[model samples]
Target: MKIVLASASQFRKRALDMLGVPYEICPSRIDEKAIRDNDPASLTRKLAEEKARKVASEHLDAVVVSGDAVVSKAGRIYEKPRNLAEAAQFLRELSGGEFQFVTALAVMHSQTRRMLSTVEVSDISFRPLAEGEIQSYIEKYSVLNYAGAFESDAVLFFADRICGSYNFVTALPVSRLIVFLRAQGIKI
Candidate 1:
């Protein structure tokens, strides 16, 4: 059976490539903003499943995989910033504090509609950052593409501590994804 990745995110694509599985990219066309849930875990899980289902519908013979992630602190969720200003603000707010990084992964056997989903939560803490530091980081990287303005480059220098899988922070959690794919009878 063929495999399909249900997202346009380069981060996810890069992570999936590590498995060495040949797959096609078929980004889901769902309106993510329309999906609402008070709980962070539920929100990410639903989004992940929805993306997989949306793509699976178009490729019934293939295994469709999808994922969604968010960075939250004190219950407020932070998605990708709209511009440099918001990116800088996000960095400032996340600095000197620990936040929850939630990643939800889903795999669907389109032929059978069998779906497996899991969530990985990581605690990330950043040391206090100065205004100049935040400004410098924002100017140096394209932080608009990632949640909490956390580009991959920021992971090493900005984050003071990480309590979970680094893959969850940078992209999809491949270890968990490997198990999900195997259960769907797809050899990685």
Candidate 2:
């Protein structure tokens, strides 16, 4: 089946690549706040639905995929930091703290607009980070690329350990997505 990745995230692209499935990016431009009130699972599902809908409306016979991943801590949702200062703040808040990452995946058909979803949770343990380290990491790795300003550069040292899919922490859960694609006979 033809699949469209309703996101331009490199992390998500990489995740899909791991599954050996072919997909194309088609980021959704929906107002995320419109469905923020929903719980973690529903929030992701709705976001995915909206995103996939955006692309599906313009395509035919394709299943569009959309997702939203977040770092939830102390009831606060941490998304990708916009700049170095905010990225530093995000790292500071996460320093020596343990937090959970919720990666939500959605698959919607192009013709029927039907949807299916899955939420994958991953835990990350942050190491004690110094101010200089955070600043340097931001300058070097660019947190704007990921939720919570995380990257695979030297900044990964900030994580002392991780439980669950490290890939999920980045945003997309390849393992869970594979199952969904397989169920749909996508040959993932």
Candidate 3:
């Protein structure tokens, strides 16, 4: 079957590429800010499904894969930071603490109009970061493009511990995606 990725995120694309699948990029241009919920998992699932459905509508012959991620700490949900200042603040608040990185992946078979979705949650622990460190990191990388303002691999030096799939923390959970694809009779 034809494969289409319903997102523009390089991180998600890279994760999918690991499966050696030939897919086309068709970004689902949806207003993400309009979709929100008190529960992070539900919010991410909704966003992922919406993105997949949006792309699937255009490509009825392809299977559309889309995903969304959010960070939750102390009952507050965080999406990609709106600006550098917010990114810095997110890092500061997450310093020396634990947070949940929740990622939702959705695959829609347009012809069948069937979708399989899953949410992966990872617990991340951070070492205490000074204000200067946070500022330096932000200036050096494009944190505003990633949820939680920090990439898992990029922030490994300051991340004390991770309690789940590292790929999920990066935004796309590849293992889960593989399972979903296999269930749909797609060979990875």
Candidate 4:
């Protein structure tokens, strides 16, 4: 069966690469900012499903996969930062605090319209961060590309703890995806 990934995210692409299976990248052109929900889970799930469905419609014979990720803390939801300043601000807010990283995946079989949606949440705690450290991190990495201004491997630097799979923080959850593909009769 043909496989399609409905996102332009490098992180998700890298995760999918782990499967060692051929897939096509067909990013959804949907306006993501137009969709909003107070609940993080609902927001991510909807975005992922919408992306998958859009791409599926274009490739009727392929299985389309898509995902979305967000970080929520103190009732605030954070998506990818728009610029360096916003990235720094997000990192500041996440400093010395606990946040929930929510990632949702949607898989659709375009031919039959069979779909599956799943959500994963990771509890992350960051140690107290100083101004210099945050500045240094911003300079060293492209923080704007990641939700909450941090990457999965950032846990090795200043994160105090992580309570879920690293791939969840990266926004892909490959192990779960493997199971989903297997259930669809696709051999990886």
TM per candidate: 0.95, 0.88, 0.96, 0.95
Candidate 1: Cα lDDT at 176 = 87
C-alpha positional error of residue 76 in candidate 1 after TM-score superposition, expressed in Å = 0.6
| Model 2: per-residue Cα lDDT over 18-124, one tens digit each | 77767777788777766674366566666766787788887777878778877777877887787778888988998989987777888777776677787777788
What is residue 75's positional error in candidate 2, in angstroms? 0.9
Q: Which ten contiguous residues of candidate 4 have the minimum total lDDT?
A: 164-173
**Model 2 RMSD vs true structure:** 2.1
Instruction: Identify the runs in model 3 with alpha carbons over 4 angstroms from their true place.
Output: none
Residue pairs with backbone atoms closer than 3 Å in model 1 (clashes): none
Residue-by-residue lDDT tens digits, candidate 3, 11-61: 888887888999899999999989889999999999999999999999989
lDDT string, candidate 4, 1-188, tens digits:
89999988888988788789899999998999999999999999999999999999999888888999999999999998999999889989999999999999888888888888888988889999999998999999878878888886676787898897665544878888988877766787
Using lDDT, rank the candidates from best to worst. Answer: 3, 4, 1, 2
Write the number of the candidate with greater lDDT, choosing between 2 and 3: 3
CA displacement after TM-score superposition, residue 181 of candidate 4 (Å): 1.1
Q: Which predicted model would earn the best TM-score?
A: 3
Where model 1 places Cα greater than 4 Å from the true spot, the runs are: none
**Where is model 2 more than 4 Å wrong at Cα?**
152-155
124 Cα displacement, candidate 4 (Å)? 0.5
